[model samples]
Each structure stands twice: as structure tokens, then as C-alpha cells.
Target: MKKILHAGNNLKGKQANPTYISFLGPKLEAVGFTLYYTSQKQNKVLRLIDMLLSVYKYRAKVDLVLIDTYSTSNFYYAFLVAELCNLLKTPYITILHGGNLPKRLDKSTWKSKRLFKHSKLNIAPSKYIMHEFKKRAYSNIKFIPNALNIEKYEVTERGCERLKLLWVRSLTPIYNPDMALEVVRLLQNEGLDVSLTMVGPDPHNKFEELKETINNKKLRIEYKGKLKQEEWYKLSENHNIFINTSNFDNMPITLIEAMALGLPLVSTNVGGIPYLIEDGKEGLLCNKDDALTMVNCIKKIHKNPDLRQSLIVNARSKAESFSWQNVKALWISALA
Candidate 1:
């Protein structure tokens, strides 16, 4: 039996998507891999003593280590794990999860430079990101999207009449939830029969105020904060149209979730979004911050039955490629 240490954050208390950590860790274990977990929050200065102590504690039995990578503060986390891996002489894989990094492992800092330059493998979830890695001239790169069990996957499709537009994202500034709200306002001013549902927990404390502002402006919208994935899954069943208003993103798991559930998307064309959805094909694409374009797409999809069905059918087909059974194999191969 092989042993693996999975180092990452425990987001249960912080209201984060722990899907990548907990779910993928256990699934890897079921395939005869013994797993261990260590939660290291993003951007915390690494206490060299503690990390060295951890290596001494677990080094004897751990055969391999897996570290989840990110572009922001979490990038530091992977570097720390990579250092520990070096000291222990354990083969480690860094699963890069950001949209910004080029596929190459080379970097200016010793941490990234060493990890990219020396790690046994580097796994990116999207080709959009993998190509970024390729620029670094690293040959160990592979693509493996996050894991979602397709057998248990069920999509909820709301009626077009409901016309409930949804944006499932934190109200953090980077996601630009305001753009979705602006679209809501634009459609309302045009007297469109629409209601926007802004789900998920807000990090910036702006959602209630955004909700109030929408009401003051007489826009039709409902702000439901922080829904559990399961609860949101049920809510999504009644939602026929999905919208993503992200400034920059790697492949979004939520968009894929919506696609699998048969939602026709009206998304801003940005980052990995274009890779997942094609204009007038799998889903509709609008320029980022162009509220009226989103408004037009909403009206277009709502009115045309065949067009809506075409998008839904194609979106679901695109989603089949992201199934956990398919994605996990990539991870297993990279690990091997």
C-alpha cells in the first residue's frame, strides 16, 4: 500500500469550497493510496521549525506527497510543501489550480523555481492553464481537472419563464459580482420579466447593500447568501439560465456544474471561460461588463426554444469531459 500526504487548507469554518481537498483526497485513498492531510492557510509565513518537525513526524512512512497549487497567496503554500519534500527526498506533485500561471514550472523565486524545476510532476486542471505551463518549457506538465462524481451528478433545470438569472460567486471584488447586478438593473430598466438570484456567501459584505441598492433602484433580484452546495444544487434545478461574471478565471467548477445540470449559460468571455464555452455553441458569450449584451442574451435564450435546447445539449456534452472518472485518471497517471 502506498502512502500520500495531501497538504492544503481546511476551509470548513471559512466557508470555502473544500471539494478539491477532502473529496479528492479520499478518492485517491480508495485506490490503495494511504492519505494524510495538513492544513496550511494562505500567505502565512512558514515556520521553518514546524515544517521540519512535520517532515520528521511523517517522513518514515509517506511514499509520496501531493500539494494543491494556486496563483495567489496559496502559491506560497505549495513552495513550502515542496521544500519539505526536498528534505525528505519524497517524490511530490504540485497540482496547479490557477488561471494565470503559464504551463512552465520556471519562476523567479527559489520556491516556484525549485518546485517547477525539480518536482516529479505538475498537474494543471485545464489546457488553457497547461498551455501557460508549456511556456516554461517544463515537460512534466499534465492536465487534470478537479474531481466531481458524475454518477451522483444530477442537473436541475428551471423553466425559461422563471427567467431567474443566477451568479454563484463570492461578492469579492475580483469576481465583479457588481457586473451581474448591473445586468440585472439593465434588464429591469428595459422592463424585462426577470429576477436575479445572487447566491453564495459574500466575503466583502457588499451583497446586502447590493441587494438594497437593487431594490432602491427597483430592480428585481433576490440575494440568497451562502447556500450549501447541496441546497444550491436543488435551487439550480429550477434555474434554466446560468451566468458567470468573472474578470479572470481558470476553468470554473461552478460553470461546469451548471453545464452538467443543463443550464444554458450567459457568461462573460474571459480567461478559461472561452475554453469551456463557445459563442453561440455550448453557451452564449458577452463582453465583460457589457450588461446590455447579457440582457440581450437573456432575452434571446428565453424567447427561442430551439436555441436554448441547442445550448443546453451542447453544454452537457462539453461537461462529460470533466467527469471525475475521466479527470481522476489524469491524476493517477501523473502520480504514477
Candidate 2:
């Protein structure tokens, strides 16, 4: 089997919720690749240290170093590791996962070029990132959709009565968790009986603030602090509509999972979301930061049976295309 070194924030025991590496590592292993990960450490400095040491240790043993490249400070982790891989004359590939990556490149062109220009290839999980890269004249790009085992997600008859809404994402400002509550508030103010459940980990202490906001408003919103994939899916049974209130985003796995489970999607048309979901087709897309519009879309889906059924059918079809069974060949070919 070919050995692959995956350098990312592999916070297995430490994280409140699992990262994408947790999902991808196993799939790669099942397809005949031995995977190694770095930085399960809680400290950022230690994580960087672990990543550098991992590359050095696996330099001769591994076929390629797979770096989980981000647009934030995590970009430096990729930069340092990629620089080391270049010095060792080892080929490495970057899996681009940042929604704000283009801005990172534009802000620091020199560093971005040094990293992208040196890597063997850059894997974009969405066409949005691919289009952004192409605009910057960055070649060596590969389009690979993020994969999930479809069997794990169960589809149910999803005609919602009380407007049971669900929002799942990290409790961060960028994701705009507050807007989810606002949407729920608007629905209730209009005398619609709606309930919301927010499921995610709190890395930036945003959950406590959100909890306070929920209490102050005295809304029927439940804050589920960080659930495992199975736990969230089970909770999703009570919900029919999935709300994504992100001010910015990429191809969110939560949205895809919601689509797979036959939940009608109401998301902001930002970043890679438009690429994943078509407005009024696969799912409903509202303008970013438009809570009133989001509320209207939910009402439209609730009252219109034909529109609701059409969205579910098309969304499931879209979700099926992203299953691991369909995507495994792409990874096998890329690794080969």
C-alpha cells in the first residue's frame, strides 16, 4: 500500500467535534493507502511542531504529503510543511478547504505562489474554489467533491407542520449563528409556530453568548452543544428544514447531509454554496444576511407542496452524486 502523510489539525481526542480529516483518512485507507496525521495537540505551536516532525519522519517512507490547506493562520502550517517537502525533494499535494482562500492569496501573493507553485497538485472540493484559483492563473488544480457514506443518512417523509428548523455548523461569527435565531424569531413574530435546534461545537466561546441570546429572547431554540455525526442525524429526525446562516461558506458537509436526509435547504447564496445548491431547484438560496428573505423562503416551502417535493427530489439526486462510493475512484486515481 502507498503511504500518505496527512498534515492538518487532527484533533481526534481534543476536539468537541471531528474534523474532515477524520472522515477522509479512513476512506483513503480502505482504498489501499496508509494514512498518517499530525497535530492532535491543543496548542497551535505544538501542532506546527508535530506537523514539521511528521514530514521529516515520513519524508522517505511516504509517497506524498497531503496538507489540509486553509485560508487562515492554518495556511502557514501548509506553507512550512510544503517548504520542508520541497527541500526533501518529496512531492506533496494540498487539499484546499478554505472558503476565504482567494482573499488569502490576494493579500499575500508571494506566499500563496510559493505554496501553490511548489505543490504537486491542489485539490478543490468545490468549483467555487477552482474558479477562484483559475482567475488567479493557478494551474495544477483538481476538482474532488467531499464524500460521505449515503447509507448512514436515512431519508424520511419530510412534510413539516410546525416549521421545525435545524442549523448545524460551528458556533462562530462568520457562520452567523445569530441569524439562525433571528430567522426563527421572524417566523414566530409573523405568528408561525416554528422551532429551531442549533447543533455544533463552540471553539470561540460563542455558544454561551448564543445561549444568552436565546434566553433573552425566550425563543423556542435548542442549543445542542457539539454532537457526533450520528447524534446530530438522530436529532435531525425532528427537523424538516435545514437553515445555513453563514455570512460566508464553502461546500458545507452539514448542508449535504441535510440534503441526503430529505431536509429542504434554506441557505445564503455565498461562497461555494451556490455551486452546491441551485436557488428554487435543488434547494432554496437566500441573499446573505437576509433573515426576512430566509423566513419568506421557509414559508414558501411550507405552504407549497409541489415546490417542496421538487426541492426534495432534486436535492436527493444532488446528494447521491457526492456519496463515497461515487468519489472513491477519483481519490484512487489522484493518489496513483
Best candidate, lDDT: 2
lDDT of 2 by residue, 1-336 (tens): 789999998886523557689899999988778998887988899999999998999899999999999888999999999999999998999999988898999998999999998988999999999999999999899999999999888888865778999999888887999899899888888999999988888888887787787888878998778888888898888888999999877788888999999999999999999999999999998888999999999999999989999998899899999999999888888888
Which candidate tops TM-score? 2
Clashes of each: 11, 0
Model 1 / residue 176 / CA error / Å: 1.1
Per-residue accuracy of model 1 over 1-336 as CA lDDT, tens digit each: 678877766455454554477778878888777888765443245433344455557888887777777777667667877887887788888777766554223444556678776788887777777776676566778777765766655755457875788789877775788888888788777777778888876666887678677868887778778887777778877667889888777888888888888888999887778877899999999887788888899899999999999998898888887777787667677777
lDDT of 1: 0.76
Candidates in order, TM-scores: namely: 0.90, 0.97
Candidate 1 local Cα displacement, residue 274, angstroms: 1.6
Q: After superposing candidate 1, which stretches have Cα over 4 Å from the reference?
A: 40-56, 103-111
The count of residue-pair clashes in candidate 1 stands at 11
